[model samples]
Target: MAQSWQRSYADMKVRDLEFMVGERVLLKVSPMNGVMRFGKKGKLSPRYIGSFEIVKSIGEVLYQLALPSGLSCVHPVFHISILKKYHQGGAHVIQWDSMLLDQKLTFEEVTILDRPIQNSRSKDIASVKV
Candidate 1:
């Protein structure tokens, strides 16, 4: 009776997430709470970032993902604990071709809305609107 009660208690709290092949999911970035990594500042970093496709289910709790070229150095297989099911929504769509990013991941300003002007005191107020 005690064993059955324990099993029921565990089932009430533990969730089993089974991800299908070709489904998109987010990868968790496990970082030290106060450390900075991957260009994300300390305490303000994103806990999970991705919409990577699941290539296959390696096992019941493991999966292989089709990561983008940017993450080629990372291992493709990940434990289910670090994966989050991604829900597709219109707001989550990205227009990759429409982005104007260059080699350094910076986009050039197409036009300047306003130009800087010097005040009467000869101080140049450099304010830019892009």
Candidate 2:
């Protein structure tokens, strides 16, 4: 039957990832249609953010994580489908402390180079360094 064939095709692509307590994982987030995320927009936006520690497993497919204070507004529990098991890596380490976020989750621009300002517009341009 068509339904049986469809199910078989879907099963081939499904991932069976398991998670244990005290393990670190990355949370998956979908980017908005027109909004920017992590300095990238559209397809360029990051698929996952933050490396949170799993505090507890609620059920077979749900988990609770130890999220940072900045993400307190979000719920602690999440479905396993939205979590990706994190592997230790050098490039994966991010300096989150230096990132400044506003209520809308947009990053604040930081000046990269110092310049002697002669006009008020120069200050505004400095903010656009990034």
> Tens-digit lDDT track for model 1 on 11-47?
9998889999999987766523544433446555445
Candidate 2 lDDT, 1-130, residue by residue in tens = 9999999999999998889999999876532356566666677655666688999999899999997887766678888887887888826545455665555445534445645434574454323334
Candidate 1 ranges with C-alpha deviation above 4 Å: 1-11, 31-43, 90-130
lDDT of each: 0.68, 0.71
Each model's Cα RMSD: 8.6, 6.5
Question: What's model 2's TM-score?
Answer: 0.67
lDDT of 1: 0.68
